[model samples]
Target: MNASDQNALVIEGGNQLKGEITPQGAKNEALQILCAVLLTEEKVTIHNIPDIRDVNQLISLLEDLGVEIHKIGDNSYAFQAKEIDITYLQSEEYKAKASSLRGSIMTLGPLLARYKYAKIPKPGGDKIGRRRLDTHFLGFEKLGAKFNYNSDHKYFEIDAHDLRGTYILLDEPSVTGTANVIMAAVLAKGTTTLYNAACEPYIQQLCRMLTSMGAKITGAGSNLLKIEGVEQLSGTTHTMLPDMIEIGSFIGLAAMTQSEITIKNARIDELGLIPDIFKRLGIQMEFRNDDIFIPEQEHYEIDRFIDGSILTVADGPWPLFTPDLLSIVLVVATQARGTVLIHQKMFESRLFFVDKLIDMGAQIILCDPHRANVIGLDRQIPLRGIKMTSPDIRAGVALLIAALSAKGTSTIYNAEQIDRGYQYIDKRLQALGANISRI
Candidate 1:
């Protein structure tokens, strides 16, 4: 939070987001790659990095620990972490920035692997639900890492005398959990295989980056991964994959406002099933050499099955509609001409943000903590904008979609919520020809 009397964003609604936009690099991927710098005392270069708040904060922490960070160019950084000082890590300023990121807990794995010890505080992120660290702890324990947690706000330590690799199975396919174990196991004493691990694009990118740096890893982008531990790893230059979530957000923005949009370098193959999922909401897209073009459609209708059955959009581990973009899909579903069921199978409280949409005149029935039924009005009555506050990253983007397509002006307090994940959201939306400004 920057020091100020009070600064908030005021948005005048009913302006469609038109024109072309390219997504910044993947935030999730950048976090993992940045932490990989601790694997060895070598210079690593990360290209196509997103200049978001989280990335900047993590870069600051890395530099504070004696890592030589140089901004080679825009969205590109070179890091050489030859030494680290954990005693200087206890500073409140660094700790606050470090703990503010959800992926900060991942530092434990790399620190333990290199220094044989790591003491990181409980990390913080969107308060959508309970993001537990039990999986992370259990995964490290399997790799010969011991943990001691003291709630007195001091002396939480993890020590590994020798990392003996073992077969580890995640209770749930947690993205960060898989990343942590992989980071720790890459420099372990033996071969490590992870089953039931999260294999999202972000996780796959991390695996690829590790492999490029001389870590022998297989089965990336799949449930099972085999990593051959190495005594040391060397630096390498790697580019992050395009952000599918940002692509989905732009798709939603275009559809909600009935505008055409083209996303450059979209990595259509990496999208897997996202294209077909958006098609269900009457959002048509054209693929052109790693680019996705969403054409303007006057008639938006949710496509029913051949049997005229109600369409159901559900999220799962992978090869399914991602939980990350479910909120954006739900907002688009609100304007389509039909009914759809959104089933959020992963998190419990993720769907609760729909209440704000209902207030904006969208018809949505909350089935429970994990499900919602949305009945689109087909733009019968224009949504009236109302002042609101951003709850989380995805939900904030959804609200922005709602407000941008609504009738009157809307003010979203705490614009910082959106800043945490997306880099320069308003400016990017403006680049897409959207009439949006931050106050």
Candidate 2:
């Protein structure tokens, strides 16, 4: 973290928080949708946008590109890409700003599709694992773009005089890769067939938003997408979905602290398999209309498989449980009655935070980089608070959950990591009766 973002949270543990809280706009969706503004010169208004660090940084990058920006209302902004400042994009200032966050990499798609040229520094994000860009350039190459990696300066460059779309199969179902290719394909010369694409809800929202902006796209919610290139796109209004990962985090928080918490307007329909996966972990929740009410429970037991085997909580592609919430699931299982094997397939380093949890008295066996065997304490022994450092956004919040449920007091360094994805989390949790304060 930079000097501006350096901070800490001192939480008084063993507090049973109560009351209702609403989640912010989906962070992942907002990142992609904001970059989509580059596809048109007309005014684009996005509503319910989260005021998180990553999203805000991307918005600033848009302004640096000469996009007209105005905050029309609370959590809403209007963007107009009337003229892009190509001069500044090649400057040192732009390089520093764009290299700070990973979302800046998505800008290449719109720039290449519209201006026939694009370049970006190698993006930086969580130090979880290797996130590749081959899927992006390979798809762009299939669309008649010339590609080259300037490894000397750690950046990528691509150009095309005329983008002619063609059939391309992604080696992996990458969300951002699918998004980059989608924006590039929407303005190409011919129809592009993308198979084995990621079908995350956020990706669906991107396609739907582009369709609203005069792009012809089919099969949004499935892995197969066909996009017929249009001459240009116009502006449109878009509203983002609630952050399902936050909703899951809140559910874990309620269970861990034994609190009665109501999460309002969660857009429960779009949270495919999240609640069910938490249900298997013995978290009791009631769906009331659009809200989820998790009541306080003295005890909840993990459910075994039908064949009488221990439950294995794992993450897979979309329509399955999302990988983002696996850390939250790992933390919640620490207090449950039964054992579970957490199989995190997406990243290798997310489970490294288990050492922090172990310091607080949770019995976890780090089987390998990709899996962990968690022996739930069943509240037989209350977790004791200790000092630890926040690793990344997801793991940071997982540690916060641990601190909130632990006994006595805990001090967590690098609270800024938590702030990257969540908006004013400390203040929101305070309203819910959590004894947390930033320093």
Candidate 3:
């Protein structure tokens, strides 16, 4: 479990996996909700939390800030931020941990709301492209906060004597930015209106949890939100929905490997456009109550438009297809009976990993930095596995899926990138009868 370990995954391909699996809690939601715990001094109990590297590191950072953490179980915890010491944020040890994950930037909002001042190191995460923090800082400034960047220390600092809520429109529907601004505005002094806000399930969950903690928030699952700031917030218990990205990855894995698998307790309602998008790629899935069942198939064909044009799968903001699942879709399309285009509009560099797929004997044309054309082989020629390194969380899972359906053994280096978002992925895959070993 050491973060510094050079881990790798050795996967044996061509296995017919079967059984039922349940996804862990949503990692994206847990990051936002965990940061929101800093808004109150009372103990907040959170259930269905994912035990992943990024979440664990964020919890450690919270502990450094003097938050009292109690482990209720493997998937539940109680967090109390009564005696937080803000000074620790400037220390080298704190900086090292905070700069390792992008979730650490979320701490700025709560700290500014509760203590009137905050310091944060430049956050780090998957280097897909330019993930600008302009929306977050602009929203903070709109709420009457002063922002400054320290060039020497490579950090950001903000101070607000009295945060006054006002109407602000974000340039883009940035999920983390919206969450940060909403958390700060909840305790501000006036009515705050947020337009063009992200309506992802993660943001909606964070808003609902805040509402339970005595914050007045309206428009839970919409692009517009209204928050009337209160003087204080109390603690509340919240449970995260299942990780939709993980569920999508499982579906791709099942289809690629010709496996019959059921994803239990998938929170089907929250998964907007995911299942339908897979259906567009000719993936057959049945909704058995709350679970999704994918049966083994010899072949699944991609659906074209009514006019017989090639279907292109692109990513965008909420209510549209998420960028996280595009990688999985690309991998699944490799074995389908038709051609499709995968467009990753959000991050330019994400499609670079397709080179690895092409090297594995798949037919992929790197259209550009944002698009790739995948021509399905109809499983006529199975993919030959080769050694490669994982680039990011989504692509890591995509590579794993490709490896599972490949014709030979494959070894993936930089397995920690996969571990960052997935919880015990190797063990879980092994439970489903996949031959994957971690070393």
Cα error, residue 97 of model 1, in Å, equals: 2.8
Count of backbone clashes, every candidate in sequence: 0, 0, 0
Off by over 4 Å in 1: 1-7
lDDT of each: 0.85, 0.93, 0.94
Residue pairs with backbone atoms closer than 3 Å in model 1 (clashes):
none
In candidate 2, list every pair of residues with a backbone clash.
none
Off by over 4 Å in 2: 1-6
- Model 1 / residue 107 / CA error / Å: 1.2
Off by over 4 Å in 3: 1-5
Candidate order by decreasing lDDT: 3, 2, 1
lDDT of 3 by residue, 316-375 (tens): 999999999999999999999999999999999998998889988999999999999999
lDDT of 1 by residue, 1-439 (tens): 4432134566677775677789889887888888889887889998999988787878887888778889999999989989888776667766676667776777788887888888776788887788888888998889988888878874456888788889998998888889989999999999999999998988988888888889989999899999899988999888998888888998888889888889999988888888888888888899988889999877689998889998888888776678889999899989889999999888888998888898899999999998999999898877778878788888988999899888888877777878878888888887767667787
* Superior by lDDT: candidate 2 or candidate 3: 3
Kindly list the per-residue Cα lDDT of model 2 for residues 166-240, writing each as its tens digit. Answer: 999998899999999999999999899999999999999999999999999999999999999999999999999
